[model samples]
Target chain A: MNRDALSAGLVLLLMAVQVTFVNRLPLPGDAAPDLVLLAVVGYALARGARAGAVMGFTAGLFGDLLPPAAHEMGQYALVLCLVGFVAGRWAESRPEAGLAVALGCAALGPVVAVVVGVVFGGAEAGVVALTGGLLPVMLYNVLAAPPMVWAATRVVRGRDRSRVRSRERGARRAGRLAGGRP
Target chain B: MKDTRQARATVGLLLASALVLMTVDHRSGENSPLGPLRGAGTAVFGAVEQAGASVARPVVRFFEAVAAAPEAQRRIEELRGENERLRYALAAQALDHRRSAELHRLLGTAGLGGYEVVPAQVIARRNVPGFEEAVELDVGSADGVRPEMTVLNGDGLVGRVVQVGPSTSTAALISAPASSVGARLEGSGEIGVVRGAGENGRLLHFRLLDSATPITRGQRIVSFGSQRGVPYVAGVPIGVVERVEATPGELTRIAYARPYADLTALNVVGVVVRPPARNPRDAVLPPAGQNGAGR
Candidate 1:
C-alpha cells in the first residue's frame, strides 16, 4: 500500500528467493546467482542514493547469513553498500535509463562480491578461484535483470497511478462541496 | 531536508553496526558473547529457508518429474556398470579373504591381537569451499567421538575428529593439507610420516631407521602407533605407496602415497573409540599430519 510497506515486502521476497531457490540452483560449481544483489541494485536504481545504500547494507547483512565460504561476516555489507551508492547515483541522474544502469550494476555486483570475498575470506583463496566461482553468477544476474526491472517498474507505476486516481477523486469531491456551499 | 539527515543517520548507524559485528566475529574465538546471537540468527535464517522451500516445492517437483525421464535410462546403464564393478570387487575380496585368513593364523601363532570395527554415519558436511575435505558427524561426545579420535570409512582412514561439539564433531580428512599420519610400509617395514601433498596425494617422508630396508611402490602403509598412545590403531590401512626416491647424500628416503579412502562421496564412517596400546620403545616423531594438504 505505502512505499515503506512495498519496500519491506520486496526485501523479504528477495531474501526468501535468495536463501531458498537461488541458493539451491546448481551453477558451474558451488557458486549461486546473487538475487539479493540484483534486488538491491534494482531498488537503489528506482529509489535515491540514500535508499539504495540502506537497502544494500540490509541486503548484504542478509547475504552474510547465506552459506558463506569463510567466517568473515560484514564484508558483504561494505561491498553491497558501495554497490548501492553507485547504482543510486546512476539512477538519480538518469532516471529513465534502465538497461545501461542494469548492465553496469550487474557487472559491478560480482566484482565487488569477489573483491570482498578475497580480502576478508581467507589467504587460501586465489584470483582464479574467485573468478571461476563468481563470474557465471554475475552473468546470470545481468541476463535476468531487464525482465525483472520491467516487472518491478510495472508494479510501482500501477501503484502510483492508483494513488493519483484516489487523490484526484478526493480533490474533485472537495471542489464540488465548496462550489455547492457557495 | 529532515529526510536527508535521517537517511544519513541511518546509513551511519548501519555502518557502525557492521563494524561492530566484524570486530566481534574476528576476535571472539570459540566462545564469544555473540555466539548465541549467531546461533539464533542461523535458526531464523533456517526458518525463512524452509518457508522459501515450501513456496518453491511445486516447481521443484515439476523439474524432478521432467528430469526423471532421462534419469531412468541413465540409471539402467549405471546399474549394468555397477554390476560389472561389483563382480570384480567380489573376486578381489575372495583373494583378500584368503590372504587375511593366512595372516590371522600367523598373527595368532605370534600372539598379536585382532581389530574391532565401529560404524557411524556422516551427518553434516562443511559447506565451505576451500575446506571441502572436512565434515561434521552426528556421533560425538555422547557416542565416544572425542577429539583425536581416528575416523575410517569402508576402505581406510578418512581423518581424525579435531573438534568435538555436544551433538556434532568436525573431522579433517586425510587429504587435508594439515593431516599427517605415522605409517609404515606393510611389506618392507619401512617407517615413514605420511604427509598430505597437494590434491589427493600423501607424501611419505621416511625416517631412515635402517638404510637396508628398501621402500617400494604399491606397498601398503599402516599406522605405526604413537609412543604416548596409539590414537590410531596399528595395521589400519592408510595409503598405498605411489612413488619412491633416494638422493645420494640424503639421510632418509621420500615417497608419495594415494590414500585408500575417497575424500569425496563420504556417507558413512567408523570412529575408533578405543585405540590400541602403544609400545614405549617406539621413537616419537613430530605431529606432521594436522589438516588436508590443499591450501
Candidate 2:
C-alpha cells in the first residue's frame, strides 16, 4: 500500500521536472522527450493494471490541471488512463516484457495524444504537426523509454524487495528468540 | 496472470471520470467551474516549475553551446585571450556575454518600436506534444501583464499573453498551430494574414488578401496592429518572406516566411504595456544589411 504512494509521488515529481527541465532542453526540432508519459509507463509495468490505472488517473489529473495547461481539463487524464492500462496489461502477459513494451508505449503515447487532441480539443492533426512535432517527440521518447522505465520500476520494485528482506530478517530473529537454537 | 475483471472495471471507471471532466470543462468555455481548481494547481505547480527553471538555466546554457557550436567557435576565436589561464574561462564568459547581448538587443528592439514594456525571463515552456508552444514568464498581473498584451524578444514578435497568474503569465507563441496574426507588407503595405504552420515555429504561413499585390522574395513583413493593439502593436517586424507559393486560381496569394524571433529557444522576453502612438514602420526592422534582409 505504501509502495503505491511512493510510486505516485515519484511520478508527480517527474511531471514537475518535465515542465521545468525536460521541455526547456535545447533538443533538435524544439521538442523535448515526454518524461511524464515514460514515468507512467515505467510505473505501470511494475504495478498491475488496477494500480496503474489509478496512478495514471492521478498523474493525468495533475498534468491536465497544472498551470500553463491550456487544453481541456481531462484530455491527458483520459489518454493516460488508457495508456496505463495497455502498458500494464502488456507487461503482465509477456514475462519478458521490458524494452519492447516500454518503447511501444512511448511511441503510442504521442499518437494517442494526437488523436485525443484532434477529436476533443480540435488540435492540429495535420501533416506538418505530424512530421515536425510528433516525429521528434516520438523519437526522443522512444530513445529514452528503456532507461526511464527501468528507473521508474526500480523506484516501485526496489521498495518491495527491501520490505521482503526485512520481513525475512524478522522471521529469523523470531525463530532465534523462541528457542535460542537455529 | 489472466485479464481480471477487477482491473478492467477500474480502468473503465477512471476513463469515464476523465471524459466527464473533459465535457464539463469544454462546455463551460472561459469561466469553467474548474477555475478555482486550476488556480490552486497553478499556485502549487507554478512554484515547483519556477524552482525547476533556475536549475534548467545552466543546463540550457550547456546545450546552447553545443547546438550553436559552429557560431560559438567563431565567438571563441574572437574571445581568445593572450594567456592560457584565461582560456578556460572563455566558455563561461562567452555564455554570459551572449545572454547580456540578448538583453541589450531586446531593449533596443523595444526602444526602436516605442513600446512601454516590462522585461521578463522565460521561466518555463510547455509544448502540446509539439502542437502548440507556450511559455511561462516570471512577470504576471503584478507586473501589469494582462491577457492579450503583445510579447516580443530581441529579434521580433514572440507571442501574446494568454493567462496571468499573480507573479507569472502564460504566452502562446505566434507559431502555435492555433495562432494567427494580422500582417502588412513592409514596402507595398499589402494586407495579409499570418498563420502558424505548426512546424515548431521554424516557419509561418502567410496569405496576402490581394492576389495582385506582386509580392516577391525577400520582402519584409510587420504586424498590422489590432484596434488599440490589445494583442499586437503596429510596425513590429514579424519576418521576411522566404518562399512565395504558386497559386494560380486562388483568391489570396500564399507565402512562407521564417519568424524573426527564435521561437524554438526563448530566453529573455518583454510584455508591452503600451504601444507606440504612431506606427514605427520599417524603422523597427534592423537598419538594413545587418539583419540579413537580403537587400
Candidate 3:
C-alpha cells in the first residue's frame, strides 16, 4: 500500500481501538486518554504540515462519527486538524521533530477542543473542565507519542521505498546532504 | 517557501470545512445528515467493543488482582482487629433492631422499588475532553433500553439513558453539569433537588425546598420519583448527606452528598426498563364501582 492508504488505514484502526477498548481502560480518575489524538499528533510530527493536517481531519472525522459522541459533529475535527497542521509546520521548519513540539501540540489540543466546544454552543466549557482534563490527556499523549511516531515513520518510509523509487532516492539524498551540512 | 504555502492552504481548507460541518450540525440538531453514519459506525464498533471486552476484562482483572494482593492482605489484618471490636458491639447493637426495623418500614426497602432491571455492561465512556460525562452501554434499543430509563448499580442510582442507537446507547451520569433530579431526604421526608457539581466523581449538591426543615449529616437520600418515572424512579438511593451548611444570605440550605454508586469504577449496571406500579389518577378517584356509594 501507498503512504496515504497506510496512514489512513492505521488511523482508522486507532480510532476503532480508541472507542472500543482504550476508552474503557481504567485510569487514575474517570479520565480516558485520547488515543486518536495521540495517533494524529504522532503522524503529523513524523510527516509534515500538509500530511498532518489531512491526517488530523480524517482521524477527527472518524472520532466524530463514533458512537456516544455527545458534542457537535466537527468540533473535534476542527481542533485536531489545527493541532496537526501547527505541529507539522513546526516540525518542518526545525532541524528535527522534537519531543517538546509533540508535547506542546498535545497540550494545545484541550484548549482548542474547549474553544470549539464553547463556540459551538457548549457554554459550560469553562476553565475548570479544561484544566481538569488537559494535563492528564496531554501527559497521556506524550507518553504514547514516541512509539506511535516511530511506527508511523517506519510505515510511511517503507511504503515510499516500495512505490516511488526515484522520489525516495532524491528525498534520501536531500536528508543526507542536510545532515552533512551542519 | 513552497512548504509554507502548502501548509497554509491545507490548514485553511480543513478549518473552513470543519466550521461548515459544525454549523450545519448545530442548526440541524438531531436531524443532522450524519445520524445514519453515526448509527452505522455504532453498530460496527459496538460489536468490536463486545469482542474486546471479553478479552480485555480478564487481563485487567488479573493485573489488578496481582497489584492489589499486598494491599488486600494488609486490609484483612486491619479488618480482623476491627471485627473483634465489632463483635463486642454487635451484642450491644442487637437491642437497636426494633428502631432499625421502624426506620426500614418508613424508608421502604432502603430505596429499592418493586421493579425489575435490565443488565448492561459499560462498553465505552465518552468524556469528550471532559465537557460531558457519558458512557455507552453494549445494549440499546434492541435490548429495550430507552431514553429516560433510570440506570443504577448495586449500591445506588448511576444516571439515566439519554440517547439510544440500534445496538448501543449513551447514558448521562448524574454528575454531569446539566443533570438535576428530585431527591428525598430519608427519615425527615423532606424534598429537594440534587444538582450536579460538574466535578466528575465528586459530591453532588442538594437544596431543600423548605430550607428551614432540619436536615442533619449522614442522612440517606433517594429519588423522589418523577411523573411516570421517565427520568428517575422512586426508591432508588441517591447518596448520603456528607454535610449540611447554611448559606448566610440564602433561605435554602445546601448539602453535599457522596453518592453510593461508584461512578468512576462502574462496570455492570441495571437499567430500570419498566415504570413504577401506581397510577397518578387513582389518588383523586374512587375505587372501581364505589363512585355512587356515598350518593
Candidate 4:
C-alpha cells in the first residue's frame, strides 16, 4: 500500500489501541494517555504543517465519529487541528526536533483541547478538572511520546521516499514521451 | 515562505470545517447525521473488542491478581474474622431454615415474579469523557434486548439499555449524570429516587418521598419497579444506604447508596426481557402467598 494509506491505517490502529487497552489500564489518577493525539503530534512534526493539519483533521474526525466518543462531535477535531497547526508551525524550523519538541506538543495539545472544548462546547472547566484530569493526561501522553514519535517519524520517512520515487517515475515517463532527447 | 502560506490555508480550512461539524452535531438531536457513523463504528469495534478481551482476559487477570494480592490477603483476614462470628449465626440460622425455606418458597412465587432474563457479556466500556458512563454489550436487539431494558449483574442492578444496534447495544449506566431510578428502602418499603451525582462523585444520591420516614445507614435499597418495568425491574437490588444527610432547612433527607454491583468491574450481566408479574400478593410487604410469608 502507499504511504498515505499505510499512515492512515496505522493512526486508526493507534485509535483502536486507545479504545481497547489504553483506556482500560489501571493507570494512577484515572488519566488515560491520548495515543492518537501523541501520534498526530509526531506525524505532524515530522511531515510539516500541511500534512499534520490534514492528518489531525482526519484523525480527529474519526475520533469524534467513533463510538465511545461521548462529547459533542468535532470538538476533538477542532482541538487536534489547531494542535497540529501549532505543533507544525512551532517546530517548522526543525521538523524532527526530537523528544523535547514531542513532549512539549503532548503537553500543549491537551491544554488546547480542554480550552477549546470548554470555550466552544461549553464543557465543564475548572481548576480541579485542569489539575486532576488535564495535567495527568498530558503526563501520560508524555510517557507515550517516545515510541509514538519514533513510529510517526518512520511513517513520515517512508512517505517521503514514496513521493520521491513517484516523482522520478513521472519524470522518466514524460522524458520518454517527449522523444528521449528534448 | 510558500510552504507557510499553504500550511496556513490548510489549517484554516480544516479548523473551520471542524467547527461547523461540531455546531451541527450539537444542534442536531437523535436524528444527528453522525448517528449511523457512530453506530457503524460501535458495531465493528465492539466485535473486535470482545474478541480481544477473550484473548487478553488471562493476561489481564494475571496482572490484576498480582496487583490485588495485598488487598486479597487483607480481605482474607477480614473474612476469617467474619467467618468465626458467622459460625454461631449459622447454627441459629439452621434452626430457622425450615421456616425460611417455607417463606422463600412462597416469596419465590412473588419474588422475581415473571421477569425473564437474558444473560450478556460486557464487550466494551467507555466513560463518556468523564460526564457519562456507557458500555457496549455482546447482546443486542437480536437477542431480545431493546432500549430501556433493565440490566443487572448477579449482585445488583447495573443500568438500563439506552441504545440497541443489530448485534451490539449501548447501556447508559446508572452512574450517568442524567440517570435516575425509583428505589425502595428494603426494610420499610419506603420509596425514593436515586439519581446520579455525576463523574466527580462515585456514590448515588437518593431522597425519600416523605420526610417523616426515618432512614438509617446500612439500609438495603432495591428497585421500586416501574410501571411496565422499562428502566428498572422491581425486586432487583440497587444498593445499601451508606449515610443519610438531612438537608438543612428542608424537610426531606438525602441518603447516599453504594451500589451492590461493582460498576467498574462488570463482566457478565443479565437484561430483563419481560416485566415481573403484577399480582395482588405483591402489595403485601413480606408478600403472603400459598406456601408462606415472603422473606
- Number of the top lDDT candidate: 2
Interface RMSD of 2: 1.9
TM-score-superior candidate, 1 or 3: 3
Ordered from best to worst lDDT, the candidate numbers read 2, 3, 4, 1
Q: Select the stronger candidate by TM-score from 2 and 4.
A: 2
**Candidate 4 chain A minimal-lDDT segment of 10 residues:** A158-167
Model 3 stretches astray by more than 4 angstroms: A29-32, A95-97, A121-133, A161-182, B1-6, B74-113, B177-199, B203-225, B240-257, B280-295
RMSD of 2: 7.6
The sequence of per-residue lDDT tens digits that candidate 4 reaches over residues B177-226 is 44678888877888888765433224666778878888998888877765
TM-score for all models, in order of appearance:
0.55, 0.79, 0.75, 0.70
- Can you give the lDDT of residue B185 in candidate 3? 84
Question: Which pairs of residues collide in model 4?
Answer: none
TM-score of 1: 0.55
Global lDDT of each candidate: 0.59, 0.79, 0.72, 0.71
Docking class of 4: acceptable
Q: Per-residue lDDT for B250-269 in model 2, tens only? A: 99999988888888888898
Clashes of 1: 13
Deviation from native of the Cα of residue B82 in model 3, angstroms = 14
lDDT digits (tens) for residues A1-182 of candidate 2: 88887777877888777777788888877787888888888888877677778888888898876666767788888888888888888877774756798999999998888788777765545566777778888899999998899898878776564321134644666677788855
lDDT of 4 at A123: 48
Worst 10 residues of 1 chain B by lDDT: B286-295
Question: Top model by TM-score, which number?
Answer: 2
Residue range A28-94, candidate 1, lDDT tens digits: 3444555666767776766666777887887677655432112445767877787877787777667
